[model samples]
Target: MNRMNWYVVYTKPKWEKKVAEKLNEIGIECYCPIITQIKQWSDRKKKVEIPLFNSYVFVKLPDMDRNSVFQVSGVVRYLFWLGKAAIVRNEEITAIKENLSNTNISDVCILPYKKGDKIKLETGVFSSQDAVVQEVTNTHYILVLESLGCLLKIKYKKDTL
Candidate 1:
């Protein structure tokens, strides 16, 4: 028998929670990470819970049973990486759960840096190194290291710059 692994499911826009609930009703293990944020209107502000990863939910199932997710409403497809279904390790899921449940964690806002902006690396081996922003995608920042004449691509989370 195949062991279960976590895979990301792409859902219809604004349907993460609905998809998760439907999947669970069918006995599939699913996780939808949520975050509470205060939204302000012209007159009043209200707290809302939103999915941390937009249009995405994590499902735990064996590789052979991956197609079962399509039975749930709003499920579009599985997230693909390098032409195959992307598998998220158990450790990553645990980390996300722990981080979301931690009360001390604060909302992190990513700085809006444009192409050609100069920035310094803060956490990696190239700490203190200067690099120019080549491209900024939704999930990654492509940087050109001037001194080393190389390119570095960094995948970032909501909490990191």
Candidate 2:
């Protein structure tokens, strides 16, 4: 039997929790990458945890039995590249664990953001709109927008936008 390495699984939109629960119940080794986010809503604002990527999840499985692993619900497929099982580098996995680690995590927690990426706030009045992250702070973020020739800086809760 081929030894298992980590493989990426594509899950349906917003089905990560269900997939994870089913996998764990069946004793499958699976991982869902998540991060804490600053959430904003109409009534109130709060910090909430959410998945970094919406439709992608990871599973530790051997290449040969990939078919058997695919039978899980909400699991679309295992990622492949060059006709072989694509490997998620150890550092990538480590980065995830390090982000999720509660011990000493406060010092390390960040938005997992990249420069020049469009993000939508999943909740709040700003939800469903595209905004550029100007700067990130512990509990809030400096959001920016360009309308014609003006720069707007608004302090938005970390998870809001």
Candidate 3:
């Protein structure tokens, strides 16, 4: 029997949920993490569920079934790492589930920076200041202001790093 593994599929813009649904309908297991948020407009506020990872969906399948997944509409390709299809470990998926389950959607956005990434403070009193990422948490990033010899932690909603 072919062993199953989790792999990330890159989808068309705004198609993460569609791809997952179609894959599931075809009997392929898939996971697309979504969070519910209140979206406000000038006229009204509405609750919307959005994919946590935009343009990406996870599919659990054996290597032999890769072509079947690719045949699905809206699936662009597999996410490749080092010339091979990137395989997501089971533990990583479990950790993601646990983290999201415990986190409030309004309190956190995705953390894209890793330790040692140089980023500029895009907004706030320290706007435009350059800092190094010292650590990352579920809801905040701990940054080190090298010149000032101080550490700062901030929560952000935009990809303004």
Candidate 4:
């Protein structure tokens, strides 16, 4: 018998929660990591919960039950890596849950950068300054500004720095 394993599923846009719920209702174990954030409008602010990884949910099931998961509404397909369903290790799922529940992860979005990439500061007091990426982290980037002869490390949202 095939043992149960965690697999990643892709859902329709904005359907991560829906797909996970439907899968659970049918007895399939599923996880959809959600993050709470404070959303502000012109007048008032409210707390909102959104999927941490947009359009993705994790399902735990035997390999033989893959078809049943696909039949759920809002589930587009399994996330494929190298032509097969992408398997997520149990440790990864646990880490994701722990990270979301235990961390104060504010409105931080990770931006991809390489060690030698030239990045321009687009916000803050350093706006318009050009720097070379020294190191990249999940929450911030270490940049070296050639003109200023100093290194700057800061947490930034995507496209803002």
Candidate 5:
């Protein structure tokens, strides 16, 4: 029997929940972390649940069954890293769950920074890498990885780092 590994699936914008639901209905184990936020409109404010990671969802299955996920709607493809399917360790998933469940941590805010500021990556492939801020955009941070000597642009959502 093949062991299951957690792999990230890229989804169409705003489709993370639907895709995860479909996968679950099909007997596939999937996780899409959600957070509740209050959205303010011109008139009123309302609470909404949103995925933690935009366009991304995690699914666990054997490598050979990776293709099965494609049958679900809104699943674009599996995220790849270094020419192979990006595998997320079980511990990382557990950490995310634990962190999210912790009520003491109300919010995680990234301080406003300007160019040339030294910062350490908090997550993703370059987690813990020291990088210099190259440019700041409304949606992303163009960073120069000091140790790797490469440039990377990471997109950020308002509530996430």
Candidate 6:
């Protein structure tokens, strides 16, 4: 295993749980971060469980062979570099634990924002640049500027990015 208890597997968009379940059914360990999302319908609304990051799922395998894991159903690929499998950091799992255990998952938190406003890039590559808000409705905001001319989306939190 060699410090590779956790590895990343790129999966079909919105198929995170299916892959995790498939892997688990065959005795392979896996973890898919589940988050709560409220779905609205004309007739009814409900809170549905969803994966936090789309197209990403985690697996625990005894080896770092990329092909072995990639062959699994719904798996597009494994995170790798220079033809070698990359290990997922332990902290990533820890962060997920905190989010699930410490926060109120039923209530989806919204970041205060709206479309078409002047914004300042506080961090990342475009930091210190003035940007125009293209879309802001919840926890994420999309920014744009002619100088960069590319969409810059960011997640917001008052105390942390």
Q: Report every candidate's CA lDDT.
A: 0.73, 0.58, 0.72, 0.70, 0.74, 0.62
In candidate 6, what are the lDDT values of residues 1-161, reduced to their tens digit?
Answer: 25446777889887899888888887777888776667999999998898765676777766744456555689998766446665655554554555455433333232333346677768744455566767765565555522212344445554443
Who is ahead in TM-score, 1 or 2?
1
Give me the displacement of residue 146 in model 3, in angstroms: 26
Off by over 4 Å in 6: 64-66, 81-84, 105-161
Give the per-residue lDDT of model 4 (tens digit) for 20-118: 888989999999878777899999999988886668788999998898887798988888766778887775566456545533334533233334678
Model 5 weakest 10-residue run by lDDT: 105-114
Between candidates 1 and 6, name the one with more favorable TM-score: 1
Better of 1 and 5 by lDDT: 5
How accurate locally is residue 36 in candidate 3, as Cα lDDT from 0 to 100?
74
The candidate scoring highest on lDDT is: 5
> How many residue pairs clash per model?
0, 2, 0, 0, 0, 0
TM-score against truth, every candidate? 0.68, 0.59, 0.69, 0.68, 0.68, 0.58
Judging by TM-score against the true structure, name the best candidate. Answer: 3
Global CA lDDT of candidate 4, please?
Answer: 0.70
Give the CA lDDT, 0 to 100, for residue 116 in model 5. Answer: 78
Residue pairs clashing, model 4: none
- Runs in model 2 deviating more than 4 A are 102-161
**Candidate closer to the true structure by lDDT (higher is better), 3 or 5:** 5
For candidate 3, write residues 1-161 as lDDT tens digits.
89999888889999999899999999999999787778999999999999877788889999988888977899999887667888877755664565457533234344343447787767734455566877766556565533222344445444433
lDDT of 5 at 47: 89
Better of 1 and 2 by lDDT: 1
